[model samples]
Target: MTFAGSLNPSFYQSLWQDCDSIYMQHQSNCLTLQDNYQVNVNLLLLAIWLDSHHQLLDSSNWQQLQQILLQWEQKLLLPYRKLRRLSKAALEQAEYQQMLDVELMLERKSQAKILRNLKSMALNEVSSTEPESNIGRYLTLFNLDSQDYPNLGQ
Candidate 1:
């Protein structure tokens, strides 16, 4: 088992590349692409869950993960928190804007769901990704958007 919260740059890079590929695959409804998406999610989730429970890494690797996580929390999760703190109407507006962004590159429903979940799971409330911002960075790193999940809302 790896450390509950650490990964080296190489490992993270591989996963990041995998995520990009998955995002591209998701652009269409091809059968091969569909299989790739499932495989990608499974691989990412495994790494995330493992990192959540174990700190499997050397000091240097841990530090690298920390820096990467911090960057993600700042750039992505922080904005998410700010958006979530807004009034309900504002939240809906922000969600709608995201739904319309071309770079979102996901099915309409999938993109909407991710935004909604992010609204509910304020940056501070998501422990699997916060405290040290583990899950938060993973999502950003993997390019997976959340649609305000009530279950994830803290």
Candidate 2:
């Protein structure tokens, strides 16, 4: 089980409160070419959760996780994301909108795969509320708000 094993998707979803608005305000263009917003945010949330639960993967595993994320981005997420980004321009076309919905589903499946990977790699149960020391680095990489989530006990 992952750090979030005891939790539900909504818990992770809530970490980035009003996500669409937060995303609009967020300026980092990290992963601009390969990532869709959904995959990126979900990965960030997993990193945060793992760190918070003192279950962050070691470097090798982290690298493996990254590779999987990259594969998903390259193979599944990016194309759909690109299409969705063009949705506004194709607004009057119903088929275009349907395509977005299908792509969104595919994107969500990709997220599920990421979550499964994290779950499979989880090696320890959370024993404390304090996060792992290296979590700050990842937070910086993703431009995530460290304060957004209350400590696990809270």
Provide the TM-score for each candidate, comma-separated. Answer: 0.26, 0.54
Provide the global lDDT of candidate 2 against the true structure.
0.53
- Worst 10-residue lDDT window, candidate 2: 30-39
Residue 127 shift from truth in candidate 1, angstroms? 27
Q: Tens digits of per-residue lDDT for model 1 on 40-140?
A: 23223323433444322232332344354445445654355345445346546767567445223333333333323223221222334434433333444
lDDT by residue (tens digit), candidate 2, 19-134: 33344434243244125333255555445555554564554555566678777677867776776777768576787778878876775675667667655554455456545433
Model 1 TM-score on a 0 to 1 scale: 0.26
In the predicted model 2, the residue pairs found to clash are none
Cα lDDT computed for each candidate against the true fold: 0.36, 0.53
- lDDT score, residue 138, model 2? 44
In model 1, the worst 10-residue window by lDDT is: 145-154
Best by lDDT: 2
